[model samples]
Target chain A: MPEKPSVRAVLLGALPFLAMCFSVPLWDRIDPIVLGMPFNFFWLVLWIPLSSLCLWMAYRVDRHRR
Target chain B: MRSSLLPIGIISAIVLLGSGIGLLAGSRRKMDLEQWTVGGRGFGLILVWLLMAGEVYTTFSFLGASGWAYSRGAPALYILAYITLGYVVSFFILPPIWEMGRKFSLQTQSDFFETRYQSKALAALVSLSSVAFLIPYLEIQIAGLGIIAQISSFDRIGRAPAMIIAVALVAAFVFAGGIRAVAWVSILKDALMIFAALAVGIGVPYIYFGGIGPMFSALAHTRPAHLVMPGATANMGHAWYISTVLLTSLGFYMWPHTFAAAFTARSAAVLRRNAIVMPLYTLSLVFIFFTGFTALLVVPGLANGDLALFTLVRKAFPNWFLGLIGGAGALTAMVPAAILLLTAATLFAKNVYRPLFAPAMSESQIARLARAMVIVLGLLTLYFAIYSSTTLVSLLLLGYAGVTQFFPGIVLGLYSNRVTKSAVFAGLLTGLLTLCFLMFSNHDPFLGINAGFFALCLNFTVTFVLIRGQKKNRLLSIPTTPRSTPK
Candidate 1:
């Protein structure tokens, strides 16, 4: 059987959700359009790729730990 | 032929082709209950991903997200927030649940509850609640399919006939192909949905205002609040946003179809990988939102928010392109509707009817019964779809509030053993009752939080208190070898 994921990896996996959920106040603005998208839209769009990366890292760490 | 008929013809043709593909995919499979409902638990990563994506990006994401953007403004972003956070929750929750499913040969979500709690009453309650909420969910899809058909055909087909046709197609494919058919059809639907979303998302803005930036700039200049949350709405402030996101994220996998779909994964790792990747699918909604935001300017003052996407597409795109978008929209509704019917039928047959009434029913007998239930349930949802006049997004949120009540029981059963069956059962009942009372009484966002959030808090409190109380009782009741303690 594969080993359990480390506490560190599990916590790291949670970062994307924390960033998206609690950072709502920070990114709920319309200024500073990134690549022609509003900040509100850009924040979510940016997190799409970033979330995949975070989960990928989590997957790798969990797999490696196993 | 009229120009509008061109799009209608193309859309009808594509939908028929999709149904044919779905039927053919499951033609050779065995018709056992396991094979029918859970795809024999043999789906690989890609199939699992597609099946999940198919379920996640329903008609709601395609039309309702854009509709909300057009109508409610920034509050619609809660859809994006909940979906991504849902994946985050699933990453932790599903693997263990999948493990339990495989170990115990579980077929449905209620089976997990039944086996874990060792109580048929709990399982029965779960089965009934799932069916109750699922009706509304199925209604959303059926209603969406009807809307797509009527609008895309330029009223050539009326809503009732359109809903009837859509429901019949879903019922036929689900009856013939079961979960395998749903999975296969989802592949086609996902591809078309992505293509359609990209086309409308970018094409509309570019056509109307030269580009996406220009489109947003115009909206900002004219209706800036529409671009941010609590935008133009009074009650849907930050608190509503946070509570909604949290409630939906927690409740995401609680949908019986989503819960049952986890069993179809070939392994736990497949589920883990899917969870990691699924949030990326939310990117599709961004493009969908773009369509909605663009529509706010191009086609202002749509009476029904759900009509926003269709109105914008009809106005901006040509006949052929409109047909493609309509075809995509129809499949989005049909794919999820098939799964919902399948899951509801399985829950009724295996969990409710078999346990409560026909314990002696054989596997094949149950399978036959489930197939029949699919037809019955489909027709019933068709009736509700044609008759009920609730908004699509609110219908979904109502379902979420009810289903999320399953969370306390499921999570406790998964991670802890001390939670008594009575406790879990009471907690679920309380949560569900709270939701019904709040929703029916129009106390949504009661005390600055969504009704669902309050229901969940009450549920967790009841569960925690009961668990601790039970532990204390057990300790006190046990006679602890007092003489041996000295030794």
Candidate 2:
């Protein structure tokens, strides 16, 4: 049980990588501009905060175990 | 030449003002190894956040990021991708590094190796290679500043003289203040850099293309592929993007200055918190991309994409705004150059020189030698900048390729019990030699994948095989789990 939270934390941390990088092709096109940026550019910028939120959740999960 | 006075004068004034802040910050504490190197390891959350963020937002982000976006098209997205992932890796690794740093008074990246692996030879290898790699990195800053100064001055001030003046000013402050000075000056550099990036990011697009959407619309209409992967290149396609992102992110915290910056934080929690919020700083880079994309359309056929920002600014804005932007760009280079010189000097004097050459040297003597090495290194890189013709983006990639080889040793050694000093040493030598062979032989991005990534994988494999081939495990991991500190 002590290590269970870390597994969850690691999974949460991987979320951003999945969104921003691992799935580049799924959203790399310039079509469908969001907030005035091409989809490729917009996807990357959006994931930055999403990445933070993921890490924040990981921190919370790990902290609960601690 | 009358146009040069306003911008040049403004740039000079701001440079002096920043130098003044550095000198005053340096005055707060007496010179010591700890104070000069790691800000006495007392930086709180905000200072630590800026200190780490400041290094990431170097001339690379200011110029190289924009330049690649302009010239290389979608390949530059790798910069944004790698940085965001870099913090994800750091979130797990840096706190452990900081925790160990506090436990054993580890001051440099090489110290982490020396203490962790318990081998002086491995420490020396790490030090020598980091310093060697940092040369190109520091050169980019010096050359980037030189470019900013020369262009912003309307070329009346020659790149050589501009580089000399700016580096000498940087040397004056680093020579006076140490890490505290660098941290204090980060305040100024970050403020101006954020403003300048925002101004250009928004201004160029709005004035020309009516807004960010229209700018991209124009680009998409004109050159549709430029907004997609492998845009404007034979290679650097999706696979290259994926591999390079992996290489850069894994190797991000391995930079000597960055790894050592963790030591300056007061506690591990400070570092973890910093990581939580630092990715938000990458948002500013969105504006830089806007600026670069605008430059691509507005100033077509410009030979050097690195100068896209300056060329566009010079063309569109008034002279005073160029001067202010140039001043911001100058600081964008100097702050990182100061820290790079400091880190490389400390690595050489403390790790390589003391451990390999002068085992009997005291800490005070080593600190003094490190201080002297700062000037020597500053001049050496200045010489390289003046004579060399390497472009800004290539110079950054070259440095990343070499320093990144350290990634395997540092990261694997952090968690794995079987990783041995000898194996890491062997792997580092193999990695560096492979890197040199590949780079000099012009095989980088070999097979549509980053050559450095190839070498890194080989290095990791070598270490893993060696460790697995052996029968022993030393239980080298300091702690198998994060030690929870009370709030």
Candidate 3:
């Protein structure tokens, strides 16, 4: 096991968590320009890709580092 | 009321039949306490997922979500926010916990404390605090079961009897099968729940509003503006909403059963994979919130809005569909109730009973004590359920705030080796006391979100200050060195 959670892994892990966290605030700002979706809806949908990408990146980094 | 007897009886019978089967099936695995309490620490990934899913998705998701939507309008979306965010937060948190559990052979939260801090008193302190926090939490689940039973059976069974029956079935399965039974039952429970939630979430809107657009349009017309967005109401100010979300997200993993399940994961990879996929499962909750909102449009002037989901379903659907949903609701309540009562029992047995009263106790004896305590705790929850006057949403929020008190110890203790036991203890105590005072006082800002968040804030601050002052304690020993042999 790595002695510390990889910095890359931490960053990857933080992406979905932080995105979900700031979703309410972030959506409020972009709601005006972000098409027809409500900030909440945008928050939920944006998570789909971010979560997917984070998981993918997490895997790639773990494999590359190994 | 006179027309409701058969449905209530049928739900009771279904619950009993499921519990009985789970009991008998899991009995063989109950040879030792560790097996009974923690499933021999080798529960497969599928079982772990079911167990995790069961714990996360409870009556709160089913009934409480709808109730909030029906009564409070759009702010109920926070339920969806917290539940989904909780799992994602766990992805980063659980691997370290699982690795530590494997290395230390930890069984309970207290066990982890004991090993990490080398302090039995601290372990005992956590056990006591956890039990105090979790009993009410378990009681809420029991109370939830009672509410669902009443709703499903159309109130044929009164709250008191329903509580008794609910608690009895849970106790029987937990006493017989232990964690193995809870997990197996959770699979069926979760499947039925997802199916039922979707059936109601999708079916109701379609039947009542004809589709999603019409449903939203109806809500837009009727409900107040604050229900939709943060800035809409003074009650949902941006700072408070964001803070509430932060508090809940941080505290999500602090629930006792969550910790217990983390220790049972087959590998760290399984946990990360599970967290990634789990949020998608939250699509069911989108339906849940829709069900709540649709209830607002269809059923106006509800006296007890908590029953809005059931009220709307009964209004929109026929008897058989109601029966199907009723069964699903029972599954939702039972799966988590079983895990919770069992986890509480294990906490009491391993942390409190064995350590304080029976340090010489064998693993088998400890297992027996745990099983017995499950029954005792289950019955106690029944008593609370029967007596509880709190609304479903209030019960859930109160439980969240109570459970979140453990956040400081569990999360920060993992990554930061400098988190001294004294600092953690002081921090947790300060947070928990503040939370209790706030909970009892019913402080401002719309019951002003539970003390869990505020408590967490103080707890972290104290831990930080304490950690900084203790320079000698900052050696940062790796509790579970990566290359070290698993205990």
What's the best-to-worst order under lDDT? Answer: 2, 1, 3
What tens digits encode model 3's per-residue C-alpha lDDT throughout B189-245? 777788888888888888887876666655555543734554234566555666777
For each candidate, C-alpha RMSD in Å? 4.1, 2.6, 3.4
Best candidate according to DockQ: 2
In model 3, which regions exceed 4 Å deviation?
Answer: A26-39, A45-49, A64-66, B1-13, B224-227, B230-234, B391-399, B444-450, B473-479, B482-487
Please identify model 1 stretches exceeding 4 Å from their true place. Answer: A1-5, B391-395, B472-487
| lDDT of every model, 2 decimals | 0.86, 0.86, 0.73
lDDT (tens digit, per residue) of candidate 2 on B102-172:
87898999998888888888888888888878888999899899889999999888999989988888888
Cα error of candidate 3 at position B327, Å:
1.1
Judged by lDDT relative to the true structure, which candidate is superior, 1 or 2? Answer: 2
lDDT of 1 by residue, B1-487 (tens): 3478888888888899889988897899777898898899999999999889988899989888998999998888888878987887887788878878888889999988888787899999999888888988999888889889888888888989988988899899999989999999998899999899888999999999999999988998899888788897878877888888889999999999998899999998999899888988888889999999998998898898889999989888888888889999999999999999999998888888998888999999999999999999998998888887756447567789989999998887765546678888989988988988998788998988899999999999998888887855552211111212111
Candidate 1 DockQ vs. native: 0.41
Clashing pairs in 3: B33-B367, B74-B227
Q: How far is candidate 1 from the true structure (C-alpha RMSD, Å)?
A: 4.1
Candidate 2: pairs in clash: none
Error of 3 at B56 (Å): 0.9
What lDDT score goes with residue B213 in model 1? Answer: 94
